[model samples]
Target: MTSLALGPATPAATPRAATPPHAATPSGAAVPVTPAAAATRRPSEGSVHSWDLSTGVDGPGTRFVTFLSGCPLTCLYCHNPDTWRMRNGRRTSAASVIAEAGKYVRFISASGGGATVSGGEPLLQPVFTGELLHRMKHELGLHTALDTSGFLGVRATDALLRDTDLVLLDIKSWDPDTYEKVTGRPLRPTLDFARRLADLGQEVHVRFVLVPGLTDDPADVEGVAAFAGGLGNVSRVDILPFHKLGEAKWQALAMPFALHDTPSPTPERIAEVREVFRAHGLNAV
Candidate 1:
């Protein structure tokens, strides 16, 4: 994810009750609240890594992007390694996140941008993610975008999709084995999500990180391009060149930087990849 301003973590808030309040039964006995009823009363909370302001790269104009914590896939080129664990993030409520974004509402709208709920993987906390999207769209009246790998796409409810104006879907790789090699997870879920988005006519920007020797194969790139093009809902394809910007973070976390020696794709290579997407009749940037 591209960011201009990296804000400090939001202060942790008081925790909620573990059990719901009991209801009085018709026989004058206290009855435990039903699971469904308790859910409605529970506040939306999630593990937040951090937030930042970015332009052009994240989505549309300038955006207030929230980076939620926890992800299923362990991508070789993940820049935010610190966000891999949910426990590493600060516990905060959805209202607090909205309040933070509300501070930049006018500025974001003026730039033709909106709010993006990104992650470690936003879908890791579907209820909280949905709350952020719904309030950001309905309350703030801003365009909403979800930046995700689509691995947990099944968790996103239709209500959440309805509130989302754009989706920055990262289709890391196309070939099943290659995808697994790049993300340490299967590719079926993401492809399934893409098809679902197409069926819903959802607007999407397919993001692909071009890494030399890893995902630079012409056949693999072609597969992604063809799939995104066939979706009919993908408005643009973003061919991002791999970089070692997160190398320092990995070292700080005491984790192996597997791609430490991997060189960024050359400008020529990047242009070639873009041309592949263009051949599919989709806009590439």
Candidate 2:
């Protein structure tokens, strides 16, 4: 419980490159480690795809964002396909990642930002996620946000939420069948997570991508608006226009790229979808 809408920023992309060969930092703490630094440094257990210091679009302000690996969902629009499997990236320790984040903490805190642990799916490594969030809040004295599909919200422990200040929950589709088709995952878990988060009074931001042929239905958008409106903790809603920016990633992976020809939704269509949320008294951007 405690999920949806962390903030309405676009979550724009910078495709992650393959992890480079590693050499230690002279401290001998393993140049590459695993995250959640949750337990003993079990090298290779927790992993990360990549991390970058970014601004204006991920969370509230500038942030040190880490993208993890091993996702249950296979969304067609996912640009971080390289993060689909944990093995694709190097094992990293939470301490190491946080230390790297420490470099930008001052700048981030100055602008009211913190850290975001995004994914292939953060919930896939709950312990690591919980520990990472805990440290970001307590040790670093910074805000913490979790960006997720809410698909694995069940994995989030109370300890994890205690460390989390916001949740960026992406609701891929409102209709169950369509949601399944879109994400290759069930929709119930996300809805369940959203409800629990609201009940817990946790802050959340709902995000939806407006895909022309797939999710442009008036009923579908309206359905999402209705559900999000019912959640008292939702602070805002982001309307992301679908794009083919990830086509190359798919091609490189040799996976089918059916959406290559799928055009982004028209401005009018996007406006219409935003209106559905607005009509439901949501702050759709």
Candidate 3:
């Protein structure tokens, strides 16, 4: 996704793919792959607090939402401004988080969906996410999923992917300029993340927010379609119609509303975006 500074979690804004059977191996020889730098980067010296786990239909069968704190991105429209501060929340050890998640093991077992480690950038706490996912999968037999921007480095990503069964990957914008404008981050990292996931043959659901004017450029949409379509492992593309539900969060945080007057896209625009995905032969969910 574009820079984290875009905004909070709203109805419209929220947060990948595979190759083939014999397609994995190269014809002649295989190029050795290395983990991403972000994965290897030293864990943030900051601590993490685990919020109470809850249920949701957002992803998987039933989600035990694990809200972790601390974020590096400054997306202006972020709804979870409360989660941005590194020191504002209480700390919970990885073991504690896993234990609590285990409490709902029955829920997960019955529903076929398990723990969802969310942000303020869950990848920021790679070790914690890895440990939690490991426990849930091996001990609890839970179906693990990651809700991430896919912008994290390979090192951290490798750890997180070890126990991850599915990924809810967000692609904020395809235009590098718009991506920088929205997230204050570069676009290549996110694209690289997607490519890496696809290369690994992971199950990914590509999500794009239909932000009026900002993310609606034909080139941008087409670019996203082209990228998602190229990934043989991508199961679906979800076009989320952007809404200002997080407008109140910006007020609560006293952040300026940069997208205040921007209304949700019309039915026609949503249809157009769906058509773009359909044209690419992607299942637009």
**Of the candidates shown, which would achieve the greatest lDDT relative to the real structure?**
1
User: In candidate 2, residue 281 scores what lDDT?
Assistant: 88
Q: Roughly what TM-score does model 2 have, to 2 decimal places?
A: 0.84
Superposition-based RMSD of candidate 2 using all C-alpha atoms, in angstroms:
9.5
TM-score to true structure, per model: 0.90, 0.84, 0.79
Model 2 over residues 122-212: C-alpha lDDT tens digits? 9888767766777777778889999999998877765577678999999989999989988999999999999989999999999898888
Question: Which digits, one per residue and each the tens of the lDDT, describe model 3 over residues 149-257?
Answer: 7666443445457578888788899998898887778888888888888888988888888888899999999999999999988888889888777788778878887
Candidate 1 lDDT tens digits, 1-285:
456776756864534423323433334344556788887676667899998988876889889999999999899999898999999799887777778888999999999999999989998887778778888888899999999999988877766788899999999998899899989999999999899999999999999999999899999999999999999999999999999988899999999988888999999999999999999999999
Q: What is the C-alpha lDDT of each candidate?
A: 0.86, 0.78, 0.68
What's model 3's TM-score? 0.79
Worst lDDT 10-window in candidate 2: 1-10
Off by over 4 Å in 2: 1-45
- Report how far residue 5 has shifted in candidate 3, in Å: 25
Worst 10 residues of 3 by lDDT: 14-23
- Positional deviation of 79 in candidate 3, in angstroms? 1.9
